[model samples]
Target: MRHATYNVNGIRARLPRLLEWLEREKPDIVCLQELKCADESLPIADIEAAGYGAVWHGQKGFNGVAILARGDAPKLRRVGLPGDPDDSHSRYIEAEVGDYVVASLYLPNGNPVGTEKFDYKLKWMERLGSHARVLLAEERPTVLAGDWNVVPEDRDVFSAKATRHDALLQPETRAAYRTIVHQGWTDALRALHPGEDKLYTFWDYTAGCWQRDAGFRIDHLLCSPEAADRLRGAGVDKWARDQEKASDHAPAWVELV
Candidate 1:
């Protein structure tokens, strides 16, 4: 089945593009990030009208995640990471679609590095790692997809040395991402396209980032070992980044048998 992940940026703002994408791509399942809307504000009817069943979690102005399925909607398995009950970032939501377990995540954007926010980002990564372990233990077809807000390697971004001190490219963030991969998960894009570089999925809207192709490969699809074995192909929908009123990010996906 074909499954896709996209950080729509803001669902309300990108409704038109999203609708067009749904009609064109027709993926079996879609994981969305950064809804930037409250739960009540979610455009539920409009999404349903677009011909897909969806389940979502949202907060006031930042951080939201959702899952959409073309068939009968999947079972809601979990919402938010388990480590801290007080953490309410609306960054995680998981579901079962067909035989695969899916998770949509929006890991924190740790801006100013030496602050509480960065620390929280690391803690959140730990929680994700723990949750992933549990899912791996289940031995089911598991696909974790989302805007991880992490640069897996220097090659994943446009420049390695240039972004060394940046929040998303910091060593801690990369290490955390590496830790997750070490737990028997395959980084689908890299595993499938071993020597390829500059296959970025996100570009900044400020300062003509897209025009210059200045981008970062923050969004990802990490599959459990078993799921990786079924990998068919992976790609970035770069055209989405060029649409009028487009989001800074584009859709990325992997097809599996």
Candidate 2:
């Protein structure tokens, strides 16, 4: 089976490229983030026409997530993280696709640190860690796929100093992310390419970042032990990011048996 994750940036704005990608890759299961559209506004018709069945959690003009199955409709597992009742960012959605349980998440980008947003990012990661523990206990094959928005190590980013002040590199944020991974989820991409330093998944649209090849590996696929056993290959579809009207992120994928 093939699994992939992509943050579309805005589904409506990137429909053409998205459809093009769907046609090209034909992955078995796909996790999508940053739909940035309300539920009622999701382009279900367009997506369905591309031969995929989808379930999505959407918020108007902001964060959203979805799961797409190539032929079968994903059985909805959950909509939002269980820890926070008042949190309503539409950033998480999980489902069952074939034999695997998959989740698509858009972790908050706590820009301009030292603020309420930064605090929320940390809190959210804690919540994610708590839920991830539960998922691990289930012992089912699963993949936690999404735009994590946290750069795990200095090696994952092109220049730590360039993004040193960003929330993604903050000590607390990295610790929170590590807490979840320490629960035994395998970082699929890193697992396959352990020593690859420049395998980045995202690039900023500004500051000639893409042009200068300045990017980071923020999007990820965390596979449970059950699923990791099936992992055969993993990589970033860098060509997608090089396209016109592309999201800052490219699809990170894994092939499993």
Stretches > 4 Å off in candidate 1? none
State which candidate has the highest TM-score. Answer: 2
Q: TM-score of every model?
A: 0.98, 0.99
Tell me model 2's lDDT, rounded to 2 decimals.
Answer: 0.94
Tell me how candidate 1 scores on lDDT.
0.92
CA lDDT, candidate 1, residue 84: 99
Model 1 clash tally, residue pairs? 0
Alpha-carbon deviation at 8 in model 2, angstroms: 0.6
Instruction: Give per-residue lDDT, candidate 2, residue 44.
Output: 97
Which stretches of model 2 miss by more than 4 angstroms? none
| Total clashing pairs for each candidate | 0, 0
